[model samples]
Target: MRVVLVSLLVVSVTCLPQGAPPTVCQTLMPFHGGGISPQGGIPPYSIIPRRQGGRVAITVTSSLGIPFQGFLLQGRTPRREILGEFDQTTTQDGHTIQCGEPADSLTHNNPGEKNSLDVIWTPPDGYEGPIVFNATIAQSYDTFWVGVESPPVDISRRSVINDPSFNIPRQPPTTTPHYARPIAKQSSTEFDPFYSGCAVTKLCFGAPDNCVINKSCKSAVAVTVSGDRYEFELKADNAAWVGVGLSDDDKMGDDSVIECVTRNNRVDAYMSWTSGPPNSYGAARLSNPQLGIQLLNGSVVDGVLYCKIRRDAYTNVNGKVFDLINEKYNLLIASGSSATASSVSFHDLSFLASAQKQSLSDVSALAAASKLLVRLHGCFMLAAWLGTASVGILLARYYRQTWVGNQLCGKDMWFAWHRTFMILTWALTTVAFVLIFVELKAWSAEKNPHAILGTVTTILCFIQPIGAYFRPHPGTSTRPVFNWLHWLIGNSAHIIAIVTLFFAVRLTKAELPDFVDWILVAYVVVHVISHLVLSVLNCTAEKSSERRVTSFPMKDLGASGRNSGYNDRSPDAPFSNVRKGLLAVYILIIIAIVIALIVITALAPIEETWTTLKSTVMDNN
Candidate 1:
């Protein structure tokens, strides 16, 4: 008999606490209304409230497997009259409530496959008004903020507390330690049950509310009213760190990031702030370590990394703070190789439309500006390279003597027209060059072939004018050398400039429709045909010059009342078959250029055009 007594004493010392367990009131019957039936879970079972002494007891219940996270009970009798604050023991599914705080919130310490909680709230001394309870719970994977309000309970019925039917079963002796999880002290970095992490080894709960999945990543987000914190869960298709952030301006700059990374086979979490795009992530700094950025859980499935993170919407940390309660926020998700790295280090990113609306007004403005610049640049390029330059070259090469009798500005007529057209072309081309720089702020030559070619052509054009200014006099002994250099540089520059113009057309096609290409094609055809006509006329004059030198000597030139050159002309002058053949050849060349233009524009490869257009759009984005 003494041995049995000793065994009982030893068991009691090992199991029971030295002090009495916290006491809580029993919940009363007569729940208010029918519970709400939500997706993926049954309706709330019952919400019973009872009073014992100074504390009020409220029990919330739901079916098994319902993902209920927490609840909020607010007094509604006379509005904020006699607030009930949680401070004592609460029970849920035979486990003690772990996440309760000093506020009107009751958060479970551990998540259970089933949902139920018994909470104790203290009312003011001598308070007599009826109290109302407003409860909110996280339904399945933090998917939705489900809520319900209880009818007012009149405290005048004193028998509700003494009735045997309303009595709660006595709590069993404590076998596990229960620690107070006060919110004001939750800033600790050590692991705590209140904000303990969670991981998804498999797709648990089978497609939670507001879940979005693609080939690269899957994600879902939920928020709660306790300091307005957000809980994020992401499953990336690749093994990489996943992150989610909130932005006030829908941009990476001035945003807060919560990330989870797997390094050396160990999963870790980080919080950071950004001031630039993802590529500039090196500038992003780590957030305050005490700011309560917790990685609740993480796992790997089929080479994909899944992570769950929680953080408050507002904090006093040394980073961008998001006011999730008062202001609308934009949510962004990204994946990267390095957990500690900045957002720029990530390879893939997604923006959720539900979090915040994206404004395209700025993008539209930029696109409109780019379109205007491209069209203006294309026009200036065509006018200068094909119209002015082409005409000037042909006139100087073939019609120099033809215009001698009709001089302008104290020079040959063709030279005067050439100078005027070139001046106008130079002015317009320079304007276009400046406009391009304005449109493309960085003037990225590597990305824009048109900008690079334009710069080269502009340089060549600039040097040609400088070279012309230093030309020797026409009658000097060095005049021949000067003319050769002048003509070589001038013609080469024109040819290169024109080639650059062709690429400009291709660039324009990227931004504009195919009809713009047709317009350019027609313009080119007309210019080429005009050049051929000049060539034919030049060849015919050369033949006529030879006849003059052979048919009449320089001694007899003065008697014919004409210059010794081929200026002499009459209706009876002999016409060569070679000249007529050259004219016929020129006509055929013109017809061929026209037909080629028609065929090329009509049958332009749709695939190639589409590829180019897609490239343009991607680059712009």
Candidate 2:
């Protein structure tokens, strides 16, 4: 019986079908797992499983408009040493290459077209069972200033060829393999072929011959003139609304804008209008209905959001679009956080105007000139003139006489300090005027309020030093005329400086952060109070001198002067009781103003409040 049983078992094993092994259906199952997505990525990761030699295709699409720039796919097998994959991703030029090891590492240069990258993965040969595949999607974050990897998304899938019973078809060569394209350098004389539309005749992105003149835009943009249409690429560092506006004037108002806003990992395209003000975007979603504006694609990768916008060179979309042909106009670029997309509170704004076709040399010269102008104007207005002049005035008015009667280097401390401050102010004013001339390139006045005020202030300031040089000797008959001229010119210039500063603050309120208004207001209050105190002191001193002079009898002038100590110019002529009381009041007012400023600055919603001010008064009314 045992011999018969063994013989029957052997026959049964040998009789099994020789064409195919037993099927392990468990090795071929649908992808079923939790809702885990790669780090920094939104979900719905499409993973297609294949039976042939354990191959799988992984595709990740952003739920938001954010484009996928790069990704890392890792396969962990039961046997670590056996882990292997042959991967591929298409480039901008439609060429594909081996994505090796950590998969798609080299393809970072070619970001996905519309926020998606197809990753082909093949597990190691001869290894079967189940393999866990994990991925980390990479894209730009925080204004495209930084790149971050998404958290690992892990899922397990069965291998197809693990059982010989299942047929594993060969994965057809989906794409032809090609060598990687080299990055092209921008050359002034030659246009690089890296850009699609930017041929010799049509300038594209990355081409030096691209005729677009960049003025104040903050993004990496490339604009080209192609026949009846103008094509452009706008790139920024983070996920937000980035756009370009075309205007007949340099101002942002009355312009048509092409915009892309990235949110929830998807980018939305729009055609917007600046019909009224910067805050009023007048945005409308652009879909199949063409208004001469077209969005080729939008993608976000490595913290950068890239949007390709196209429009006819000339269009009459009810005056919504400007002509971009041979005419001169202004091109502006602006970006806002997602929260301010509707309001268009762009944190970044850049502009260039008087744009026309230019030669390479002309473009280079213009670029250098623009840069120099920006730096010079910025330094003069923000630091040199505004900052130094304000400081000098404050020091001369407040600190100069704070140590009255105190001597330094055998000179009156007040006089020495005041002279030093005034000299500094004069030098700063000269430099500021030179910078303004250099920036503007001409002496045309009344162009704007800022220019007019600046010109007047500069003229008044120049007269001060000349008047000082012509000052008459003390006690001379001409001294009173000199005094009056000096006082009138000095006070007039000072008042103009204050007004100019106010106008400057108003003009640049949009550029400044919210808290700057509080700072400016505080300084203005302090400055006015200090000037009042100085005026009152001068009046009181004049009254005291008159009293002393009238009280003296002409016949007994020497005795009266000696008794009243009027001839002394020493430290003993310290502030009187009334002057001391005035000083106390001045100090109290300054302290109170400073405290109030601090409180207001701390509590105010600077940007919002600033917007309200503009809308209520400066902008609308």
Candidate 3:
């Protein structure tokens, strides 16, 4: 009887399914223990949230339409604590199990393939913190993934907190608040409460200069002073982190930084210090217990990260003291896409500094860093490369023989016009190069090659006129060498300049639209077609019996044009009228393209400009 009982126990153990154990309540990991690693790519499944009445209805569906066999889903807090309860009666193809709390986790009840699963979740009463739905999906016993999360859904509280009349209880200086909830009023017209009383009741700073007033800023910060306590609100759209720094100067190093970072679907406010360039080292978090910074409320909803923090008016960080009432400081606002548990990634999306330092006690609008110099730099470059340089090169290449017997200021018409346009190109490029250096005040920290390429193009352009002045005499043995060198340098500079403009679109400071590339492509197409037509006309002129007037001396002309003259209105001039007509058409097209590009450059971030203009027109009407 003992042997029969032992044999039955062994048989039951071996017959169990090789999947997640039925006791997976806390660790959420599957029981497929063969030392296999989970998949590293994005999971094929996603959790979709829909608000039905006061409760949330969650649906787990395959993002790529690939059916899943098993999954474990739960609602988690920022601290990784389980919250709320899942209704087992309303769950489809799944059953609720307790994970530290009653009915707090949901998992597959059967191994059958399912397209989706639906469950209703009710938040704990009076809980206003954010909740994220995290899941571990299993396509098969061995193929599974862990830690897939959905966008956070914020729970509404019974009372509003951002009202001006609401008062917050002060805590000890050494103790920072962890999860204090402040509910901002939400409406269709004014969805964010942070913008209320900005620049009037509090000092506001943001990018794009006047975006705070226009209500169109992607990132912004506001500070309100009440006696020894300073309340700060940081907000940004489509960002993982947003921060504001207080610096004595406009630069970033050795500054006091207040950061609002979204990690695990919740926003946490922390104090940090900028040590150097972001490429070398990002802002380092301060670990002092006496930092005196408190996070009042924070939430990450629909890709927007919002945080409200409070700090003592007098506080010390890393041996440096900040006196909010007596000290003046520049405000720097920056936002980026990513952050780790300990450090934030580079702020590549937006970085704006105030025009001047101001006291925290002052409640007024603050101006952002001036983009006037940057805009001027872009406009000058467009005028140089697209307008002057293009026209100069065209005249030198194709119209040299077309404007026969014409004299402008004692020089051939083509040569005179070419020299004028080339001079303008040189002047404009030099000024633009200087303007950008003045605006940046140092080397660009961006990883793109726009600065390096622009410098090389300018160097080549500067030498062109100098090289021409020292050209060898006509018909000399070294004249051919000079001619070829000039052609090579000129063409190289022009091509490199156009390519540099393409890189400029990606520059954060330029703020140009992506479709600007299509405009550039159109210019190239038209320019090439014009060149082809001119080349065909030149060939026809060469094959005709009538001799054409050569721009150079007759000896330098090709064998077919050895009989050509250098005087205007020569009876032997071939197709002169047709060449003149084509030149006129080409000039008109070049001017139109250059004007369009220059206007776009001067008014970058064109979407905002259009909106502002449209609003103004409606107001005027």
Candidate 4:
């Protein structure tokens, strides 16, 4: 008997499960038809007095998944009518009603917490209930102020709450492709029961309610079945914004795994039939249901599980659905265990009819603004670059003319032009940084990535000026070191600046798509060609006089360990070495770009573009 008792004691302790931690989301003051007050009072905009069928419910369970014995849900409005009340013992399939005695056990309570209560209510009556609310759950959401204190963050907020107030727009009378051939089908499957998170179906309206009001009715597969699917046809008088619902998350709460597609204006998704015991089904008893194509104003006449539509909202680009959650959120599931989403397919027949295209002038405000931004910066760059080239060549020509007549280059010439170029560059950079920062400060879902890239680019550009300090005064130790530093900073600045340019293009609203790199490539080409043209013209005209004698001496010109007599007339001039070095740098940059492109291609799925390019290459070959 002692040996058996000892073994049983060990098993009991070992088999005990650890209690779950309390939710980070604190309780929220219940909302009447009105908003919640800070001092725990209901507001005037809340449910009015003596209305019927208005109900709200709150349930507070112990952290250990045990019930608060004897504590029942209880709430009454000023009218003294009970709108909602929690049961002392609520029994579900496997759960027993309050079978344990009422005890305030600190062991199952959150440390340092006060009273634990759930507040559910039906307005005082006569009120239509709250239309929209800015309620704080547990965490702050977006820029919308939840409160000074963080809101109770809801892990999964579920509700069987239904609103009959929606007038769901009737179909617009018109002829469109959506009304043509349509595929709406259903499969033989049962609804799944509700569990932990997500929604489960029940006969909320009762069987006699006649869910369909004399419309096309179909049954489990044929005659008529009162199911959860909503059916309607819209002319797409506007766009469709569909919400996703699922099972297994917090009961009555949202499944965070689903996210809106990038092309919000047009969406496509596959439907599930009996996916993993969906709201009502048994394993091997059902198949994963399939969804036929859906158009903007068409019908899901076939009773499919999912529908596809071309939407009107276009801000969904670049949005990711929970990919970074595992690293950022503790509650996230492992990548291998979670559901793998099948790619959705949608075909919009009325895309052309419902499609939106704007005139150049309509978008000119932004296009003009983008051009102004580039012009605001580019014009300055062109002036500084071409102006410096102009002044330098002009000064060189003037000095050559003077040398032909037996004179030396002027002393103040370099200082004057260099100071002017430096001042102009400084001004352009300052303006660019200030304006770009202001533009990027807003948290726009559509433009945040571009804004971030712009900010980074602006910061890198500031390095160019720091590098310029290396050339404080020419004739320093290896004057060329300053030149090299300046060159490296300049090249890096160009890369970052081009990155900013792309962001700008992405942020600006334009009728036609504009790629920043392509624009930059064009701008740089034009700027360089202009500089080269001016230099060559000046060089050609003054060649004869350039050979004229100068007192600076041939020894100094060739002192850098490379020589070319001042009067040398050969195919390879010494300054030509400077030109060759510049060309080589450009070639190296292109080689780097090619290598980076190859690496990026290998890392990501770029098969679509690669296949097209390969086909073209094959055709050319």
- In order of appearance, the predictions have TM-scores of 0.37, 0.39, 0.66, 0.28
Task: List candidate 3 stretches off by more than 4 Å.
Answer: 1-189, 251-254, 275-292, 316-320, 340-343, 546-573
Best by TM-score: 3
lDDT of 1 by residue, 472-551 (tens): 55445665565566567777767677566555544422323345455556656666666666555555554766543222
Ranking, TM-score, top scorer first: 3, 2, 1, 4
Which regions of candidate 4 deviate over 4 angstroms? Answer: 1-418, 442-457, 469-472, 495-503, 506-522, 535-543, 546-621
Instruction: Estimate, for each residue in 86-142, the C-alpha lDDT of model 2 and write its tens digit.
Output: 344322211222333343122233333224444445555454444444443334211
Which runs in model 1 stand beyond 4 Å of their true positions? 1-371, 445-448, 505-510, 514-533, 547-621
lDDT of candidate model 3 versus the reference: 0.74
For model 4 the local lDDT of residue 68 reads: 21
lDDT of 3 by residue, 1-621 (tens): 999999876644331233344476556666554344678755656565654334666766653446677788889876788878887666445677777778788877666666666677777768865677888888765688888775456567634322333222322222221232222323221324456566656788876556776677778888978787898888888898999999977766788999998876456778999885434435899986227788765655445677778888887887899888889999999888888888887776777889899998798778776788899999999889988898898887766666556689999788899999999999999999999988777677667899999999999999999999997665556766676777789989999999999999988788788988988888788778977887777677767745544434324432222232322445324666876787788778878887887788787778767777887899999
Clash count for candidate 1 is 6
Cα displacement (Å) at residue 252, model 1: 12
Which of candidates 2 and 4 reaches a greater TM-score?
A: 2
lDDT of all predictions, in order shown? 0.46, 0.45, 0.74, 0.28
Model 1 lDDT, residue 25, Cα: 12
Better of 2 and 3 by lDDT: 3
The candidate that achieves the highest lDDT relative to the unseen native structure: 3
Candidate with the larger lDDT of 1 and 2: 1
Residue 64 accuracy (lDDT) in model 2: 46
